[model samples]
Target: MMKIMLVDDDRTMQAILKTLLEMDKHQVVLWDGTSESDIFAQIVQEMPDLILLDYYLRDRNGIEIVKQLRQEPQTSHIRVIMTSGQYLRDECLEAGADAFLLKPYMPDELLRLLHQVQQNG
Candidate 1:
């Protein structure tokens, strides 16, 4: 099991993600039913193995968070998956996401990506 963070602003998405990850025995950290706040500092302290971030968050864009994580030496290596309804694969990749997932993605797709990341890393 891996320690993963689900950083989407949508409560439904967060619940779904948490349930699915927990089903597979992966430990999941959430936004605690609130918008991601001071997320950069929180992430640095928590240091999960991976993060699944929404492209357009309630408080800030996921790319900005990704960039900050990459810029900081301590959190730079954590894998991030950026998901959005809009097309942002290239931009998110450029921002340092390990993978970009379009919204409404299937559970298997997300699971496959996680497996791949763990395998490669």
Candidate 2:
């Protein structure tokens, strides 16, 4: 099972994703999207196998975050899957996400992508 860190601001979405991921036998680590908590630090501490990053966060931009992650040597190789309600797949990929999922995507799609990323990694 992969350790997946979920970075999203919506509580309902968080709950739904946590349930879905847990059911798939993957460990889920929820980030509250608080600006006070250093994102990089949490990522390093968790050492998650993958990161599910939401595009439009409350305080920070997920695209920028992904760009930074790719730039950092310690975090560059970590797989990231970006999600957004808008059609920002190209931007997300350019920012270094392993994959992009549009919002309201089916649970099966997410799980499929998760496994696909693992396989490709």
Candidate 3:
């Protein structure tokens, strides 16, 4: 099974995604709130197979986070999927997200994306 890390400030989103991903048999680690520094550090320790991040983080911008992640040799190869209710599709892609998923996505779509990431990884 693939290990996924969910980084979002909204508790509801984190919960919903966690449930959906878990149902698909993926191991999920969830992080909520605005502590990017701590959260990134934790991610380094956990080293999940994939990362699903919100476009707007409470502490730092999602683009910045992605850049930082890509800069680190250890975490650079991790697949990152960015989701947002506000950003445009191209914006997410341009920001270095491997995949851009809109908010309130269907479970099936999420599953497909996860599977694709797993397969590609």
Judging by lDDT against the true structure, name the best candidate: 2
Model 1, residue 65: distance off in Å is: 0.3
- Per-prediction TM-score: 0.94, 0.95, 0.91
lDDT of 1 at 110: 94
Give the Cα-based TM-score of candidate 3 against the true structure: 0.91
Q: Write the per-residue lDDT of candidate 1 for residues 1-121, one digit (tens) a residue.
A: 9999988778888999999999989999986634366787678767899998899987689988999999989999999999999998999999999999997889999999999988887
Model 3 lDDT tens row, 43-83: 89889999998888876767888888888999899899988
Give per-residue lDDT, candidate 1, residue 116: 93
What count of clashes does model 2 give?
A: 0
Tens digits of per-residue lDDT for model 2 on 26-89?
Answer: 9999985666248878888888889999998877889888888899988898899999999999
lDDT, candidates in the order shown = 0.88, 0.91, 0.84
Rank by TM-score, descending? 2, 1, 3
TM-score of 2: 0.95
- Model 2: clashing residue pairs? none
The RMSD of every model to the true structure, in order and in angstroms, is 1.3, 1.2, 1.5
Model 1, which residues run further than 4 Å from truth?
33-37
